[model samples]
Target: MTMTRKDIGLATRRAVLGDAHVARAQEATTAFDAPFQDLIAEGAWGRVWTSEAISRRERSMLTIALLAALGHDEELAMHCRATVRTGASAEDVREALMHVAIYAGVPAANRALKIAKAVFAEMAADTDQTDSEKGGDHDKG
Candidate 1:
């Protein structure tokens, strides 16, 4: 069977953001916002994110910079959390935000840095906890 655009987009969204995040959004979806959700699924996730023009890591960095420059704090922080899945290292984010500072503004980059730092710290703590639970000092990105 051929997959529809929504199917392709939902899969791409899950791959980029993970199942849990997608589940949360799905669970929170209502009749009023259903169309909006579908729009993003078909547009952002399907058309843009699913494109092969660039790697996910590069896309992650670019998204981060745009989110930061646009002052989309909530989305900016969420993308920072998604870096582990996107393979965008903290250093990559730092460099991206540097561009934001130069081309966008200092304040935007500063706020993005704080958000990224907090998210990374939380991710590290989660990793440390998981490692301790497994009785090994496994390092995670």
Candidate 2:
């Protein structure tokens, strides 16, 4: 069976952003912004992200840097969290933001770093809670 672009895009989107995030976005979507959402899904995820020319890790870093440089803080935080699925490590993100500091100014990098730190911390806490729920490290006492 051949998957259409929309299908491929949605699959790629879920793969990179995770199901929970996508679900939240879907839930938040209304008729008002439906077209905008479709554009992002088909354009950004399908056209840009689905390209194999660059690895998702590289893409993640690039996206983070671009978002930071553009002062898209909310989106930046979302991308920072997406790094978990994108395989872009914290160090990789930091390096990307360092480039932003030079090219996009220190203030942008500084703000992005702060947002990334908070997002990473939240991700870590979520992971810890999931692990504890699964009884991971329960014997460490």
Candidate 3:
């Protein structure tokens, strides 16, 4: 059976943003914002993210830069976290933010970088916790 736009979008969104993040967004959706969420899932995640023309890593980088330039701090931070799944490196994020600084403004890029750094720290902490839980590395020594 052919998947609907929402289906495609949901899959793409979960893959990029991780299930926990997507689930939280879904659970928090109010009746007023539900339609808006569906629109972004279908339009942005389905149409844009599912596009094969660009790799997910490239898309992540582009998205981070665009969000930074637009001063969309929350989305920028969310996307920065998603970079772990998208294969965009921290260095890649830095380069994108630098581009944002040049084209957008120093203030915008500065704020975006700060958000990115926080997200990166959170991601690293999560990994460390998971690794510890899994008896990673320390068990080998």
Candidate 4:
């Protein structure tokens, strides 16, 4: 049977990473990129990211490092956000960037670090917002 877009997305996401990570990706995908997201769900996520040859953590590190090396700041930022769901730590990102600095050049790593820092800050703000919402709910109850 042909895989539906949602099915492809669900399986691809869960296989490459985890449910939480995929959920965030789905949430972050905007109206502008919804079509692109669908394409990725079928092409990248469905075909490649679901491969069993590598672990999710390894995929996360490699994806971030490569994106940084290639100067794909937006993609790097997206992957960095997904790293949280992939069970990667900030320390892992630091180590990856250090390697990128050595292998990919200092300038690339520098830019990647700046991008990651901003993404991380945004993530922190999102978390704080969620916590505040939960607090508001508790107060109402």
Task: Compose the digit string of candidate 1's lDDT tens values, residues 43-139.
Answer: 9998899999999999999999999999999999889988888999999999999999999999999999999999999999999998797775344
Model 2 segments beyond 4 Å from truth? 136-141
Which pairs clash in model 1? none
Stretches off by above 4 angstroms in model 1 are: 136-141
Task: Provide the RMSD of all predictions against the true structure, rounded to 1 decimal.
Answer: 3.6, 2.3, 2.3, 4.7
Q: On TM-score, who's better, 1 or 2?
A: 1
| Ten contiguous residues minimizing lDDT sum, candidate 4 | 12-21
Q: What TM-score does candidate 3 reach? A: 0.90
- The Cα RMSD of model 1 versus the native structure comes to 3.6
TM-score of each: 0.94, 0.90, 0.90, 0.73
Tens-digit lDDT track of model 3 for 3-97: 99999999999999999999999999999999999999999999999999999999999999999999898899989989889999999999999
Clashing pairs in 3: none
- Candidate that would win on lDDT: 3
Candidate 3: lDDT over CA atoms? 0.94
How would you encode candidate 4's per-residue C-alpha lDDT over 1-141 as one tens digit per residue?
987755776786775556776789789999999988788787777766767798777888898999999999888987888887777877798899999999999999999999999988999999999999999999999
Q: Pick the candidate with the highest TM-score.
A: 1
Model 3 alpha-carbon miss at residue 114, Å: 1.2
